[model samples]
Target: MIIKEYRIILPISMEEYPIAHSYTTTAVIRQDLALGDDIEISKSEPVTNIRLPDGKRTSGHFVHKVYHLRRQVPKWAKVLAPKELLVLHEKTWNAFPYSRTEFSNPEFLKEKLSLRLDSICAPDRGTSENIHCLTPAELAQREIIYLDIAGEQIPRKEYKAECDPKIYRSTRTGRGPLVGDWQHSVSPVMCCYKLMTMDFKWLGLQDKVEKYAYEAERKVFCQFYRQMFCWIDQWYGLTQADVRAMEEDTCRQSCSRANRPQGLFGSKSAVLLPARAARLVPESKSLSLPLDPSTGF
Candidate 1:
């Protein structure tokens, strides 16, 4: 298994991040739908009773989203990869200030592959020691990376001037235009310490796929938080009820676009087709891994 810890510092406070996160995620879902990618929210409900590892009780929300990326795959890989392999199942347990998300492929890859993320939001400068309570063995193998939202260089293809932190200033709260040495000067700074563990047990593809997962996680973090800061004007001043109502409206719209029944809160779709083991073997050199969504961050 590959273990990585990504620390991302943002200008928002811990109290206000949940609203911004939900609002931005809803917007991202719509954008994905517009790009011909289908997302099914298999389950979404409120969790009022959650027992933490420290034996403390808390309340939070739960959401399960399955991503369909048939259109995003290369044509050649489609011939070798099965329909089931094209989908990713995500279950997120979000208790603000702390959350855990798991991503898995179909049943066939249950033992061959696995991914889990644990995040802790704090008001410090990424100085927490073992925030996720990782084991000694896990800590020895873990890689820590600090993601500078205002300074990190993303791919040119994914860059947007509107999302650039150096150019965009927030109209609400006035926290924008993060210039040099902003981490020391930014007021009300918080860090999302995210721990990602992934393992792909394929014979020839295990190493490459594990390395790719780290990069994928990093990309998702930088992109999501950059947009989170840039879109502050829209989500800033929103309450919990306000965000929940927006989520409901987005769910209805998603159902309409998917042409499926609405309000299937606890339903799981049996849409993946089973394929033979031989058909699952693809040319490793030409295979590209799908990017997981930014959930529970």
Candidate 2:
């Protein structure tokens, strides 16, 4: 098992993050659809009194997604790998400021592999206590990687001036063009402590595949947040109701669209990972703050 904690500090406030995140997720899902990946939102609803790993209960929204990604795998692998291996099942329990997502494949991988993501959002400057409450073994095995949205290097083909944090500025919030040391000086700064855990046991392929998964995850996180921040003006003033409406519309559209086959080759790094191009293995479970027994969100 490979465990890693990724800390991403953004120049957005805690209050605005939920909206921005929701908007970004919907947009990314749509982009995947446009690329010909079949996305199925089998479940999207509210949940209450959900038990946490720490024995507390919380309430929030839950979502289940299935990605049919045969086209996202290389042609050679398509001939070698089983069709079921190309499909992915995702279950997300989102209680704002804290969310847990699990990813797995059906049948074969359902028991041998596990991928989880636990996200804790805070308004601090990237230094919060051990929010996920890792056990001694987990703590010792985990690696901490900080994602610098503005400073990280990107491939030329993947770079977009519009999404570059060093260039774009939000007109509405006036919070942009994050320069060096922005994580320390930006107003209303927030941090997302994303804990990712992956346990894959195969024929000597575990280590290589796990390493590639982390790299792919880092690429996704950096690019996703860069776009999220750059598109701040669009999601800045959106309310929960507005996001919900947009999601409903997206769900409707997804249901109506035909599930066309596509290719594994794409501009996005998430799809171009040569090792496992079709699967996204980001996941988590948690510990730091007091769980609101009443609301759970």
Candidate 3:
């Protein structure tokens, strides 16, 4: 016979959860949250203890204390200048599915969200006018506060982190150019195989793809791409000479940047002017345009 002892985990309030407050856009992430709020869980300390077979009490938290879930805000998202944490008091608020917004337009929300027949959001749907009209059962539902910037939903990809900063990454070598990675040429635009194909689909031809013979050389496909741009320029009343002049100027600018003196960044290539930073990407190994539009090389 053996006696077993188990230590139970006490659930902490949302306020006590380390990540709970990080989501807040307020000046102090945790100031609004009180220590004694209605809680799903609570703990006096962040850790729970378990006794080992040798009777040693080892303590550990749910996550490594050193690793915080909500890390630094992405540089791009931060540049968007998000303001206000919009809280939805009621679930019935119509219009966008987002329950909360980081950017506040309170008056617009108040005026727009309504149950009135003529209200812009309601659309004559027979739903209760106010949240108070709902029963306790109905009131019990999932509440989510989503981040919104200015007037648009933050990109879905932004919410999900693609790279882990904590993990050290070694430089990759001798690999074939993957589908979406940039082309080999150094230029004023970091034109990738993916971006070009997408640009081809969205910008130049709404539904048409460039036609070529089965034995067509790589230059043929690239020329088709350039010709489409030239055609677009012609449509916009630009002559071939104007196109040539513009191409020369752009090429000169690109070459000047490529040969410019190296700066504090150590590598000459790394030191790009403000305008040039968006231009050149590190050269890819591939020399040819992807033949397959569906799966770029």
Q: List the residue pairs that clash in candidate 1.
A: none
Question: How would you encode candidate 2's per-residue C-alpha lDDT over 183-205 as one tens digit per residue?
Answer: 88999889888888998888776
Rank by lDDT, descending? 1, 2, 3
- Cα lDDT for residue 136, model 3? 49
lDDT of 1 by residue, 1-297 (tens): 888888888888877776777677655554554554555555655666755545577876666667675764556547766777877777776666677777888744766778888777889889887887877998999999989998999789978999999988987788879999888789888988888888888887678667766775677678778888999999999876786676566656656655766554334532111111101111100010011123343
Error of 3 at 30 (Å): 45
Two-way TM-score contest, 2 vs 3, winner: 2
Candidate 1 residue spans exceeding 4 A from truth: 47-59, 72-80, 264-294
Point to the candidate with the largest TM-score: 1
RMSD of 2: 7.9
Q: Against the hidden true structure, what lDDT does model 3 obtain?
A: 0.20
Off by over 4 Å in 3: 1-235, 260-297
- TM-scores for all predictions: 0.83, 0.82, 0.14
Better of 2 and 3 by lDDT: 2
Candidate 2 weakest lDDT stretch, 10 residues: 288-297
- Clash pairs for candidate 3: 11-41, 11-42, 12-41, 12-42
